[model samples]
Target chain A: MKNIYVAFCCEYKKVSHSKMLWITIVLFTFIPMMMGLMIYVVRHPEISAKMGLIAAKASLFGNADWPAFFGILHQSVATIGLIGYGFVAAWIFGREHSERTMKDLIALPISRSYIVTAKFLVAIVWCLFLSVILIAVGLMMGKWVGISGWSHEVFVHGMTKYFVTSFMTLLLITPVAFFAGYGRGIIVPIGFVIITLILSQFIAIAGFGAFFPWAIPGLNTVPEGTEGMQLFPISYVILVLTCLAGYLGTLAWWRFADHHS
Target chain B: MEEIITTEKLSKQYKDVLAVSDLSLHVRKGEIYGFLGLNGAGKTTTIRMLLGMINATSGSAHINGMKVHAGNTNLWKDIGYLVEVPYAYSELTVRENLEIVRRLRFLDDKHVVDAIIDRLNLTQYAHRKAKNLSLGNAQRLGLAKAMIHNPQILILDEPSNGLDPAGIYEIRELLTSLSKDQGVTVFISSHILGEVSRFATRIGIIHEGKLIKEINSEHLEQLCKKRLRVKTKNNILAREVLLQNNLICEEIHDNMFELESESAIANPDEIATLLVNKGVPPTMLNVVEEDLESYFLRTIGIKGGAK
Candidate 1:
């Protein structure tokens, strides 16, 4: 666990990632605010006009449910956290491939699984920094927008869904990270993700395309009239499955995969 | 002596390519076994399999008789690994890295950790960040980190990869002396054969992902024969005599001839006498033991790949 934390904090202190987190929050929060403010200033829209737009765009954007917020959160995490996780984890294992430090680490009496677990947990922790900032932005944006019908039901259901989704989403993204770590190349994971995304369209023809790790961020789209009742979709079940799958993927790879480092 | 580590026909394959094929290795208690191989020879992969980092395609491996698995192995508690170059949290202090290892290994004794730090001469640099330390100092910290838990089996893969000559010597001295002093069985995988020549009692050669041979250090010495080199003023006469006597003579250069002979029997005086009998005892005569460099080249059959 201490080893886990040490590995986790690797990205927090690195200047490049620190700058990325700051830049994400600053840009994401301010860009939305600027866009919202522009509508008010230029159009001087009537309340009816805004309400009409919400009513019309309900399928697209209006409900603004926890799933939607978390969906966007998943995208942010996937785009930013996925890259960081894969890159850092790549560096973590790749350092051994690129240099001789792997010998220094493996000769220890410690188990290699523990080392991999520590790195996986560390990547999770570092990725969480991005989520923490995003959640803060979400809180601030909710208050500023005066979108308060805040209920314990919404908070509990949404927060659970958010956390579980993040954990499960990490499970999905991390397998690629395992490849990145073992491959120890800068472009390996990046190329993997791009190819996966491109080919995913053909793969998604199946009903459980929702179960595919790439589509996890957008799993929860609340249909009309069930807004108040907290019913997690069957797709949400895929989160635990995916998390289990991710852990097993890492274990299997570690068990069978060659360490180029 | 107890066998601390053993591998039974352990093999690892990558796709169509086999990286480690049918390796069976035995490491005795309190012995330093140097695993010799060049780059791309699968030394690290073998260690990783033993450490349970990768699963074997076939066969089995055990540390302290416990079978290697992906996770949840008690063997890790008994082993310490230094993979390649030493690394820790670059931003964290040296003490922090050592503390993490100690804590992860679950040693309650702060005194033990501190004692290791003191012995490693890292007390002064305890507060300094790992990345800030020199390569040698970083290696010292890595060694300290591995030793902090006091594991019985120490598996180091290329530990001297980035160290200077002095640092390499220190590490060699440290590992060689570590077993007798601390009762630790050390398995050191290195491409640097000479460093471990005097340092390891048993040796294993990995060539092209195959465990080409496993031999006792003494047998390795035998295979690495000591040649009797004689340079006479009249090389043609000496060559003619050696050929007529059915002695194996290799022409090293224009004037020098190398013969396969027992150094104990064929001393410089003996060689000089032999040359005198041939009426050409007019130059250098020396008996030298076969070194690891020559032995490795001859065994692997790849020329100019000297270390």
Candidate 2:
């Protein structure tokens, strides 16, 4: 309980940092809203399922023909979340080095790994908070657009895929958060994540997206009936583990940061 | 009491450059230890290694007797830090920034930060965004961030780097009180020797990745430093006078000789008068001391011995 409180406080500090506040809020709050907007745009009656929802879902939910509510949630955790988190976290991590804050934070009496874990937790919480807001907004939009309760199975499958797949993706992306957690510089982790994402797609064309970190979209691949199985129990765990890795990494940095500071 | 931090032969290598060489350092519990060096003397690098931000090529360090590692990070609960510049969310309000740190350090009692705010006199400015604060205020906020957790140890890097004189004095006083009253062990660094000397009880100078000098404030005080800038009619004459007097004049410019008084009995200003009496019109004759700037220059030999 004490450690958790400590870690919680550790992460909470970042939320208040005036420098990265807007970025944090945007990535954590507004991006989901944007995801909803895009879904709302693509699902207009004018674009009615010309291909019976492949393009429809792609246009709106990226792959899920979800109802207004679930569609927004699906898109956020997957595509939109990736783009938003990528730049934000990357810069946040890089700022430590660029701004040279690593010297101070690491020398605190706290455990180094705990700092890393705390940050990872902060990012996850940010993601979760955004996901919930997006879900609420999407549901409201559904009611507004009068597409409420549309039982589109493909939508359920796709949303579930993203929800569940985000975990595995998180597991795969743990190293990235780890790198950025301490990289403090833009070049190393940003370049690595971008190249990895692009290569994941190419390799998948060679049938390796199954193993590629970019395969997040693929894992949101409905395993027929299991649906969004990963979200309810698994991917969220990945989020936890990802957060854990970050926390641990931060702790490690703290332990030895004295020299660097 | 056990040593709070001890590094045995710690060194950091950045590809080709050895930022910190094999260095052994010791800081006793509750001591205010200052790491001093010129720019790029590996001060930042040394701090990074102590915090475990970067790996050491070879060596080990312990914090409160525990070897630096993941499981040991919880020990950070007892530490506070303010790096070169505070890394904060620029958009968040000061209150918000404190909140994030409070939550991240997992501190539930707001009193810790409230106390720090009161002490730092940051409450009136608390509502403003941290980015909106000026450099000195930012430094205050950074100190607040580090101390908010009420840790027993503070590792601060150049806490007074960018601040006005009053601000610098306030921070120094605060640090002094933290050590004397609260019993917090502080590890701080500054390139400016005078600044570090204001609050540091002990000082260690690192030059070119090596721990060249580690002296207590008492010893540093007895070093008998005197700064004399004497202007002679001819640069050659000034050089001859300074060399003959066995004074290692640091900067010799046209018609001017600048150096530290090499002995206790020697009066540099008196030497200037003698030169004037000997027929050189005294353009500028001043004996300035009471700081570590020149001693630092001579000791560290700034920037690989040339500058």
Candidate 3:
């Protein structure tokens, strides 16, 4: 356990100092700011007309109230959260291979599984930090734009869905960790994330969001009861099963596979 | 002498290509075993197998009586290694890279980082990122990480690569002292035979994934081919006199007679006397020993000289 702690500390140090961490934070901040600009333009039609084509795009969100704002935030988290969290997993695990430092990790006093665990721990922490920042910045931007219908009950309701959506997205990132290990670098894993994100849209449109692990979070964020977006308990089961498979597969790969590089 | 490292017919077949085949060798305690091989000669593959970074197709490698496998993490507590071109976290500083190793090795002493940096003459570059380092300084960082824990054994692959002559000499001196005074068993692999011959207590030559020869560094001098080089004012007469005496002599391009016969080399004074008796009057007479490079090539049969 001490060995694992030590490895985790080392892994944390590597991630905390990385430029990628700051870049991801800054990138996630822009999403909420963009959403706030759309809200602001919708609240004032004169400005929307002056904005022209971008205003037409912003008006597509229907209204400028807190409910519309929170709905947009929830859906954004479900989609953007997958890519952001997957990238975090990819960087944490694939950087060793990309930097040609994988050989150094082997033959150490600590077990290979500990190293894998440490990497996953760092990835989880990084993703959670990003998720928190996205919501915090989104709330600030919504208040800045002065969207109406703000209440304690509504805020509580919105944040609960936000946190759950983020949790579900986090759970789905484990398979990405497996891809980073099996593919031995970031390119393959990032490709996997992209393909899964596209397929999630198709799967949800085909009325099978609960059956697909990647589409479950987006379905859950769809305002509680939307026609085909109903999520069954079996969806969570599939997600948990996927998470277990990816986690165990990565550990087994690290422990048993030949690391020629 | 106790064997600190031993391999028995270890083989690794990567699909159709055999990277290592039937390789068996031993490294004794306090001995610097130089694993000499050319590029693609299975030196790195063998070292990787010893570290359990790759699984051997057959046989096994043991370090300190523990069989080498991924689960044998205890054995690595006493082993430090640098495989191939050493790479660190490029974004991390040199000190940070060493600190990571120190933490992973579970060394409680925080001062070991500064000490290793100072010892490797990397104090000035301690805060410099690894990507900005020159090849020689990067190599030093690699060596520092391997030596930070002061492990009982070191497994380095092509350690002297990308270092200046002075850096190479410094590393050689450091390894020699560690092996001689601290009883550190060093298993270093290098294609440069001349460099390894300087400090290795013993050397095993591998060619085409096979252990072709193993020789003690002390006896390497005697084993290297030597020739009696005779440079005289009249080279023709010197050659004729030596040939008539049943001495096999060949005239090289620089107007000198080379007598490769064991008798002539052992009794060079006799040849000198014979040359002077014929009035050839030798200008220079010396027995030149073949250098490690030539000896290595000759042993590997690449020089085309008779075995």
Candidate 4:
């Protein structure tokens, strides 16, 4: 436990000093603000006409209401959150190899398992912090756009669904972490994230999102009763299993694999 | 002396290439074991296996009586190492990087970082980011990290690389002091035989993944081949005169005759007199002992210039 704490502090300090942390924060903040602008455009069709392309894009939001705003926020979390959270995991695990510092961590007094755990802990905190930013900024934008149907129950329900979607997306980041270590750099993991993102879209459209871990999070964003989009109990099991496999795989790689680099 | 580090028939096979094969060596307490090898000679691979960064294919490494394995984290408590080209988080300052090491090592004393910074002459660049540091300074930072905890053992690979002459001398002095004063055992690997000969108590030469030779530094000088080099103004008569005197001689280079005979080297005056009487007076008569680099190359069966 003490080892974990010490390693966690070191991992936290590294993340805090990195530009990636702030970059992700700014990016997460920027996404919702752009969504708010679209909501504002949907609210005022006359002004949206003057905006041309921006207006045409805003038409997809349908109505300028709380449900529409929250729906867009959930879908964005499932999609954008997948890539963003995966990037966070990739940077945290892959930077050690990319920067050639992995050798320093291997033979430390602290266990390599503890260091790997600390990295995941930092990644979780960072990704969750980004999720909060996405939600908080999205709410502010909805208010600024003067969307209707604001109530405590609605707010509670929307925020709950948004967070659950974000949590599911965050779980899938572990595989990215594994790829980061196996590949010995960020490029492979980022490539893995992009590939998964594209496949998630296709797999979901093909009606197998319930079985695909990458597609499950995005499917959760759909209305609970939407045709062919309903998630099965096995989907959650598969998600957890994927997360577990990645976590264990990363630990094993650090412990058993020959780290020549 | 008690052995502090040991490897028994340790080998690592990477697919088709065998990086290290049946290697066995030991470092006694307070002894500076210089691992000498050229590039791609399994120096770094052996170090990695010793540090438990990689597993051996056929044998094992043990430190302080404990087997080396990734799960054996306790073994690393007394060991500090710097492998090929030390790299820290580039974005972090020198002080911050040391601080990270300090926290990870669970050292309560915050002053160790400052002390090491001063000790390594890195006080001026304490606040500089690692990315901004010059190669020598970065190498200094790497040494600082290795020595910060003052571990009982240190395993460094090519540590003198990227350092100026002065910097290298300073590090050598520091490491010698650490071994002498603190009773620390150092296993350092380098391609520069001459440099390692200056400080290492014992040297092991590895060639093509095998431990070819091990020699004590004290005996290294005597083990080096010595010969008498004679230069004369005479065209071809000097070689014949020396050869006729029952002195084995050969013209190694232009106007330079080399005599490897004990009698010739022991008493060059006799050869001088014989040459002068033969009217091929010697211009340069000197006994030249082979340098460590030459000896190293010769031992490795490579009859070429030093690496």
Q: Which number leads on DockQ?
A: 4
Judged by DockQ cut-offs, the docking class of candidate 1 is incorrect
TM-score of each: 0.72, 0.69, 0.93, 0.97
**After aligning candidate 3 to the native by TM-score, how far in Å is the CA of B298 from where it should be?**
1.7
* lDDT tens readout by residue for model 3, B259-283: 8999888998888788888999889
lDDT of 2 by residue, B24-45 (tens): 9999887899999878888877
Comparing 1 and 3 by TM-score, which wins? Answer: 3
Model 1 ranges off by over 4 Å = A1-132, A135-233, A237-244, A254-256, B111-113, B209-224, B241-248, B261-281, B302-307
Instruction: Estimate the overall C-alpha local distance difference test score of candidate 2.
Output: 0.66
| Tens digits of per-residue lDDT for model 1, B40-120 | 798988988887666789999988878877554466777777766677766567886676666556676878778888977
**Candidate 1 lDDT over residue span A1-261, tens digit each:** 655554344323442323444554465566334433333332233643566644343334333444444444544454444444445555544544554444344433445556667666655665565566655666566555544356787677666655654554455555565566556654676676666554534544443445565554433322334333222475567656765665666556655555545
Which of candidates 2 and 4 is the stronger one according to TM-score? 4
Off by over 4 Å in 4: B245-247
DockQ (0 to 1) for model 3: 0.76
Cα TM-score of candidate 3: 0.93
Which CAPRI level is candidate 4?
high
Q: For model 4 chain A, where is the 10-residue window of minimal lDDT?
A: A60-69
Cα misplacement distance, residue B5 of candidate 3 (Å): 0.4
List RMSD in Å for every model shown.
6.6, 6.9, 2.8, 1.6
Tens digits of lDDT, candidate 4, B110-221? 9999999999999999999999999999999998889889899999999998999999999899889989999999999999999999999999999999999999999999
True contacts kept of each: 0.23, 0.60, 0.85, 0.95
